[model samples]
Target: MWPDTTKVVLRQGPEVHIRPMVAADAEALHRFFLALPEEDRLFLEDDVTKPAFVQQLLAEQEAGRAFPVVAEASGEIVGYGVLYRPLFGWSTHVGRVRMAVARSFQRQGLGTAILRELVRKAQGLALDKLVAEVVEDQVGALRAFERLGFHREATLGNHVQDLSGKKRDLVLLANDVAHIWEHMEALVADFEPSAG
Candidate 1:
């Protein structure tokens, strides 16, 4: 069973709280999306300008097909993370993760904590793999995923275009839970918590 809560310390920093996203969080999420810089927003394909998009996200959460969690710092939303499931039977066991943090919260360990929680959630679902498609220019994001045991599986060239109309490569990274646990025993030590 999945634990009701998962906790982690942001890279060499203080503890951060992670909890499931709720319907009430929609407005906050909308505000957060609006606050994101263009560079950061470029990676996401969501239409934040439309209210229906946010409603759809909340609806998806209610349907159990997706998991969205928000990282809180002193009761404020600092970042958000989501794991989306594939629809087809053949790919149902795979999940794709997306993460974003407020610029002020970046590098403060919020991203790491959010990712740790995501991995835990994926494991609870018995997923075989967790995948992430990161823009090539996002070196920090790539490194962060690597620290979480993700490995680059493929590179899709010109997968996206930036606001400036520059083509960007998409790096596909995947993490196999079983393989990661076997090869990095020490890393998973702290992540193991009693099921509650």
Candidate 2:
């Protein structure tokens, strides 16, 4: 149902493992979220710190409603990518993406690798479009998705509230799935995490 597991070299030269999330990863996933700063997670809609939430995610994956993947560096979870496709709705033709990389691993091309895999899967499923909701001030995220060819579609004002009780706009970005699918390899190949 998902793409094959991959091993890629990070900018800093360490190897990271990327693969589809499994039921056994619940605990690791929780720890991963716990390791992230609140700033990196405040926009997440799912409360991933709870076991129940991970269980629900496994269920959703089994039922084919969701595809969530994880990235591990040095045997610890450092990244996550989730794509949701509604079975019945006006958005059946579209899949939404949610992803995060640990603060330490932010500039290492892990996010791009995850997104390329998500787009590849969406293409296999014949999805016409892919979308991502990024908070207005998340400059890194905005650039990551944009690098993959996703364009800004619209901005929803006050769409999300942060931990500080401040309102944040949601930047809706989208790409034509088929287009990305056709160009995925080049995007993946051109990924230069950084030699620093």
Candidate 3:
């Protein structure tokens, strides 16, 4: 059996709740993906309209190979986060995170809460590290990850080109769960404790 499941209770100022996504959530997930801005969509590769694609993602989550979480407010999916297994065998212990919160919900602490939950889930899966790739211009995303203990590891030059034919740099960030835990005390002290 795998190690204990890592579950992080997410609270968004007492209004929204975050939980693991299920197969039944495919349609909602699709809607969220479809609503993403073109710039944000460039970071993730997927065809939300395909049932096979959704099924594959759901299967991975059920098999302990990935995690798909959804943020809901009044029963509506407003944000989503995913942590998937690494591609290379040697890096199996590492996981990559992809997250997006609806534009209306951005800057309201939902992103931070979702990131914390991603880290919590990764640690629970016995993962050694969590990685995120953010476009260089996504200052908010970069800062969010940095505030959550992620450190910039590299910058992939011109990794993506938008519809406008403009190139963008992909900034890689990584966090060592063990190292973060070692400084948990100080970190907790820096932020006021709030119930999740």
- Which regions in candidate 3 have their CA more than 4 angstroms from the true location? 1-14, 45-53, 180-194
Clashing pairs in 1: none
**How do the residues 1-196 of candidate 2 rate in per-residue lDDT, one tens digit apiece?**
5767878788778788888998888889989898888878877776666778778888989999899999988789999998889988788999999998999888878888788778877877789999999998988889888877889999999988887789989999999997776565676567654321
- TM for every model, in the order presented, reads 0.83, 0.91, 0.79
C-alpha lDDT (0 to 100) for residue 34 of candidate 2: 88
lDDT string, candidate 3, 52-162, tens digits: 767888888878777878888766788888888764589989989988888877766677666666667778778898789888988878887787778999999999775
Q: Give per-residue CA lDDT, model 1, range 6-31, as digits (tens).
A: 55555545455678888887887778
Candidate 2 lDDT trough over 10 residues, lowest sum? 187-196
* TM-score of candidate 2 against the unseen true structure: 0.91
Alpha carbon deviation, residue 168, candidate 2 (Å): 1.7
Candidate 1: lDDT over CA atoms?
Answer: 0.76
In order, the Cα lDDT scores of the candidates are 0.76, 0.84, 0.73
Q: How close is candidate 3 to the true structure, as a TM-score?
A: 0.79
Top TM-score model: 2
For candidate 3, the lDDT comes to: 0.73
Ranking of predictions according to lDDT: 2, 1, 3
